[model samples]
Target: MLRGPRRPLWLCLCLCLLLLLLLPGAPGHRGDAGPRNKKAGSGRPWPAFQGLQERLRAAGALSRRYWALFSCRVWPENCEEDEEALAGTLGLKSDLSVRLHGQHLAGELILRTVRGYLELPRPDKALVLSFHGWSGTGKNFVARMLAENLYRDGLRSDCVKVFIATFHFPHPKFVDLYKERLTGQIRETQERCRQTLFIFDEAEKLHPELLEALRPHLGRQAPENYKAQSLRTIFLFLSNLGSNIINEEVLNLLKAGWLREEITLEHLEPRLQAQIVESTDSAFGHSCLVKENLIDFFVPFLPLEYRHVRLCARDAFLSQELLYTEEALDEIAKMMVYVPKEEQLFSSQGCKSISQRINYFLP
Candidate 1:
């Protein structure tokens, strides 16, 4: 027998218990799922965190990203497909753009602005586009197309923020409150990623003070950092204020027997800006953004003719991945009621109701 100093009998027993607890298949041993299994052991209750982890992984958040790290070996094909979707949408003309029907000017201007933005080392002013036209004339639609092409996740990305005048800031009396909130939102958004795009819809109804608040964000000339930040950010103004004026001009030209091509941006800009001043109660033309020549472009969406409406119906149908024929497209277009019975010239509602109109044709 070895004559070693004997430890306490209780101490020896405690050491054995600890070793057993640490071992696999030991009486008290359990792995990471130990807590999970314990709940299941009694009534087989599921763990919330485990299920959530699965969903996040499926949505390509956690595990998917980790998996993407090794995607070159696992799934290289997906990387090639739509790999440059974001850039492609911006740099090239999309299919929907080709189907823009009567909106060549708007499309060309969008492409020009995008091309110019990409070229600028540091843009002095943000791409401040005021999309002016009647409802469903593709004002919001073009803005959407631009947003989708600019960012991968399209409008869903946090970089894109859309504020509708009626819904987001309905009260004019709270102009100061709205101004502060709007300023804070932009400042916070720009902090995260200066490549932020703010789309203010129904801008015609925005409060004068609120629109004035955007002036600094657009044209800050001092500090290089401020100018750089503003350069990366884009502000899109969507409104229906100048629709009637645009319509009238178009009709007058057509009545005078002038070709559509003759009706140019040169003629429309002054007319639209003048109408914005007369019709819009907000700071549209009155704000420093306008007076200072800060608005980079004023894109007008003109009234859609029958063919244009048909193209819209086609686009809407195709978007839903639905099949259709010329007849169906024509039928939907015909259902649309145009104004001024004499000419029956253009769709009164624009393509705004295409989603609803398509339902009639859909099985």
Candidate 2:
């Protein structure tokens, strides 16, 4: 105590000890050590499926479509392989199903035959190409919604002449490569179908070159007196790309007439237009399309509210028919609590968050 220099050293040591004690796992520490150290299998539960029974009753929905996507199916061995062959095709490792955030994130590519030669009285001629974004699957919520809508429009599994080809772009590296592969596939498949609609889920991932290649085909009408072949080809590029790439190589392609001017601008929805204009990033901040050329259809990003969450959760739960048990739901729910609400849902962070918890739960 008498030596000034020695006193400061002793004070510094005490302060460090105080910080150590304050940290988790310190003696008498009380805060949650996070989902990792929670009591085995004791966590927030998934809202019970039975709780939604009344809601379903009021909605007058009782079909498998209401809850089948979430449920895992052990299809006959090679069912996926057969389905791929029947549809345009993609290589997948497992039966397609939506995964809980707590489970390992697995990527899958699927092709569901919307309509074809068998159902149609005459050969149909149309194909729809769909692309999904980061952390988004080819068969996730948005894709399923679009599919259901298409199915309701007299487009049966093998009629309407529209072959739906979906690809999974889980990594940036996969984007250009996927486009190259898809271009070849589309060229081959187009000959079989009369017309084609290329749908890009998150078009931003698509390379400029690919979009350029498809531009010549988008919105082109057949020659006059061509028997009205009903060849209404469409290219639907859905992206959060917006105006951000104002000066990127891809944008230059658009400026240089690589893409059809009208198709590029008219296809982008208004919300995306705003995002492009408002964002500060050079790549996405500016408009992707020139004046008068916008997206054909624009589905805005859904609002963020508890009601939206409840709706999404209900939709997700009902889509899968409550396959997860109460315990499993609890484990997943607990894991989600550690993730920020804004950052949750169809995001890679959700995957990492769950993986961390799973590691903690396992021996």
Candidate 3:
């Protein structure tokens, strides 16, 4: 007994406290909470405990996972939350179909392009999607839909970065500085995340030099050592550059008796490319990106119609759990101004303010 060394007082005290926490019916034990505690129940873990187990299992945290199990054993109600789960094509499709309106082409094209690219075992280049449309026509909405479905945190994810032209780089003299920062940020983000998304809002306002700097990232060659699906990236360019052209083309299609669903990429892509090339006044239109054909798809968001606006209003009301009438829906739709003087076909503001508009009906 003289040969044995004494245990440290603090270590012994900590062990005793841990033992107390695990003992059922002991003071400060997990069972003290109630019958729902794992220690008190009939060998059944809480529903949240089961969820924790499943998530830990999927994450393949074999070694450290026991800590979670042990923690859950002591306190079932306080399991840690896992990172967000990424959605597949079906989930993306369902969200876009349910939440988005009046842009059949945008929904279908975005779904196909994104899903297909994500499935590729080894993509040679980043998936560059250029979204063109008038203000309030779901360009930003579709971008958000893609973000929400692709990453767990959506736009808020550390892997996702958004750059606005007018806001981020308003001065022409600062083009060099913006290009350096932009390129550096892209490289840094890609290095940090296996899959990354970069969104350029008001892309048309981006400096030509800045867009040129992005050419290397969007090119057909992948970054060195970035092979297969180990590194995946998607670049979204949202702009109003070709909105007028999109509106005119859509109107022509409607006048030709073609249904909205019948409109195809063949009808829009070529024209969009041509417009971008012809637009020498804007940085986006004159950028080497357009000339190089680096953009994989130019997704067009069609101007929303009255029916679409009404649908948006209905959704807005339901979202707040507020009761609404057909009259209310009509009133909301009518409140929006339609353009093209004669036919008055589409909502100029799209569904931009429908959520706020519902406030009027809140009693």
lDDT per residue, candidate 2, 148-260, as tens digits?
Answer: 33333322322122322234545555657756766666565454444433455545544444554454344333455323443333344444443222223223444466632
Error of 1 at 130 (Å): 0.6
Model 2 ranges with Cα > 4 A deviation: 1-140, 148-184, 194-197, 220-222, 225-234, 242-271, 277-294, 314-320, 323-363
- Tens-digit lDDT string for candidate 1 (1-363): 001132454544544444444447766343442112122224324423223222222222222222322343245676642232223333235433444657777877877776567566655667788888888887776677666656656778777889999999988788788888889989887777646789999887777788778878887456656743533677888888778888988888888997765678876888888877675455566767678887888998878888778777766766575665567777888998897689999899887778788998777
Count clashing residue pairs in model 3.
0
lDDT of 3 at 250: 91
Candidate 3 local accuracy as lDDT?
0.72
lDDT of 3 by residue, 1-363 (tens): 001123444544544454444446655334221112122234544423422222222222212222333444355566432211122344467667666788889999898888788777667889999999888888888888777656657788888899998999999998888888998899888877778889999898887788889987888874565553326789999988888888899999999999988998888877877887788668787777777888888898888898889778876765665656666778888999998999999888888899998888777
- TM-score for each model: 0.72, 0.39, 0.74
Task: Give the least accurate 10-residue stretch of model 1, judged by summed lDDT.
Answer: 53-62
- Please tell me which model should have the higher lDDT, number 2 or number 3: 3
lDDT (C-alpha) at residue 271 in model 2:
39
- Evaluate model 3: give its TM-score: 0.74
Best by lDDT: 3
